[model samples]
Target: MKRIVFFLGKGGVGKTTSSAALSFYLSRNKKTTYWVSIDPAHNLSDIVHKDLHIKTQIDDFLFAEEVDVEGYLKNFLHETTNRMKEMYKYLQIVNLENMFDLLKHSPGMEEYALMYAMKEKIEENQDFEYIIVDTPPTGLMLKILSLPFSSKMWIEKLIRWRKRIISHRAAIANINPKKIDESLALTEEDDKVLKELGYQSEYVTFLIDLLSDKSKCKMVVVLNEDAMSLSESLKIKSGLNDLGLGLDFVILNKEGLGTVSNNIEKIFDLPTIRMPYLKNAMDTNTLANMGQRLAKIVE
Candidate 1:
């Protein structure tokens, strides 16, 4: 089984360290595992003490990478521009490079790019027993995680619109065969656009199904004792619930509560795992021990 785990929380909440440690702990069990950092400000390399700017083999059973989001976005946008040119011949006059520069900063592009990168990773690396992801902080993380559900609707609508256009063209051509423009006739490019849209729609559906399958995926929300942390965690919980995804655990990092634990468990509706503040300097050894403790709780 290819099990995927996501570590999520507000910034400075120790998601990167916890995810790295957990990945190492799991790898020690002789299971093939890959640790990935998708955060734009990735600290996984420093935490893991390896240069993982690209995919690197830590050992026989463990691999690591800090995903290059900009790189993926560039490639994704280039392909998208090509597709648009195929579908709309007039698009050739519009400079796509400048258009993409603006589009890169658009609302949903980053999230969709990250989602597409994830889909590529999962499909390419199925031999690993576990794939652990250290996500960006709360807001972007939720958007990235929820892209499949939200994007599917838009893609489906686009598919329908394309089909209608094709049907209308066919009807016009049937009514007046002499009036049809050869260039306007349905070509291989139009067919390719339809195929590409269908593929994208199905890919998003696959992501939705994979994430909702709790047996294959787990979402770990890391929080601290601070009130702000708790509040952000609540929003994260609510958002996940709204998207019909279940939380696997609520990790209260850097503190332990005496009697307040009951309240936390009640509010989050999941078991709580408390990690003590690190009095010692953080290192591989210390993180490994912490991961051991976390494994006991999460397992």
Candidate 2:
């Protein structure tokens, strides 16, 4: 089983920073790890100050990639559209190009595409010991995390609807010899795709198990000392509990004066870690130092 860790919280709360530091530290221990950026506004390359997109191998044990969702979706749409065109010939439809364009513009398309890519990576990179995902901000993170369930439900509904439509079409075709077999064929093809989606959703159970496994997988929620962030973190913790996922720790980043010292004892009931605010901006050296500090928490 792969150990998957996600650094998630609101934007500008240092999730990217924590993710980079943790990935770096984990790599040092000779674990094969891939640090992935699932955020649209990717700063992973900026933080490392290197172009690490498209499966760049930084070291023997470490790799990184910034998922290009649009690029992936374009390729996926092209293939799907071609298949649609081929199948539509049976329905005697003059063109299916417009439908392809409409599908591209459909709601939740991007999310579904990205989830498909994630599922692909998990299967393709079986050699890696750990996969560290740097997710988008809170709301998007929630959507992405719950995608498997949503996608499954949507696909099932589509399948049922398509089956009903095909049955109706077949009845119409029996009376009128011009019965376009294309619509039924297209529905069958879509059913196959949805079947794959259902299988992938089931496969995601491994990821969920890895996340909920207290000893193997850990979720570290990074936040600041502000009240809003703290409250959000608490809600996130509760949400994870509702999903049957356990949060191993809450890391309070860039702690200000009196906050860590005063609140540290109170928060100690929860497995909490803190890092002091640095005067200068972060660099690789600074991140490595922060990683050292975090290692103590893990120890």
Candidate 3:
């Protein structure tokens, strides 16, 4: 299973920078790694100073495009609508098309589609040792990670219902062979895809371990050295612990002016990575240097 390390925090923090830096370091160390951007306003290309639409091989590792969530949602809706049409035709119903259209607009669609895409990527890419995720802001980040468990529960219930329907139809199949043929044909295809979703534990556990693993995978929270950022860091720590995940470290970005305080030290036990305030935003060379610095911190 691939490890997924997330660089997450509030907006304007150094999450994207840290993600690019970590990916650079991992790749430099000869790991076949991938850094995926889940942030809508993606800046991985800016940090890398190259377009990542195609896989760019840097040193021993490769970087690929961020998951296009809208594309995933479109694909998912098309497949699901096709399946619904097949079922409606089998049952000789035309009125359900409106219902199907409404179903496409339901809540949680984006999250579900993203989870499906992530699962597909993990299953397909066996060569990569690590999949570094540059997640969105804190609230949305938690929702994305929690999706697998929620989706798994929903899938299990649907599987049970499908089994029950199959059994119920089996009794009537002998009496109505033509109807049974159409019904079974449609359901068989659905079962094939649904079965693939059934075996999603590997992907889910990969994420769980990434969140929980202190040694190999770490959740590095980036924050400014201000009262609000410090408070948010405490909240993030509590939330991660509530979810059975541990914070590997807290990075105080742009904290050059502050003298070290006892209160800040007491709030967090893990080693802190302090980055000085830069007059200008980072360029590729600067980001690469930051990557080297982060490598030392992890080491």
The TM-score obtained by model 2 is 0.78
Model 2, residue pairs in steric clash = 90-182, 91-182
Q: Tell me the whole-model lDDT of each prediction, alpha carbons only.
A: 0.80, 0.70, 0.68
lDDT of 1 at 214: 80
Report the lDDT tens digits of candidate 3 across residue range 133-240.
Answer: 787788777677677656556767776876677666666766776666653633534554445445554566565544466666667788876777677777787777
lDDT of 1 by residue, 26-98 (tens): 7777778888888888888786678887889875578999888989888988877677766666446777657
Count: clashes, candidate 2? 2
User: lDDT, candidate 1, residue 168?
Assistant: 81
Clashing pairs for model 1 are none
Model 2 regions lying over 4 Å from their true place: 86-89, 93-95, 157-216, 257-269, 279-281, 293-299
Off by over 4 Å in 3: 1-3, 58-64, 94-104, 122-126, 168-216, 257-262, 296-299
Clashes of each: 0, 2, 0
Q: What TM-score would candidate 3 get against the native?
A: 0.78
Using lDDT as the yardstick, the better of models 2 and 3 is 2
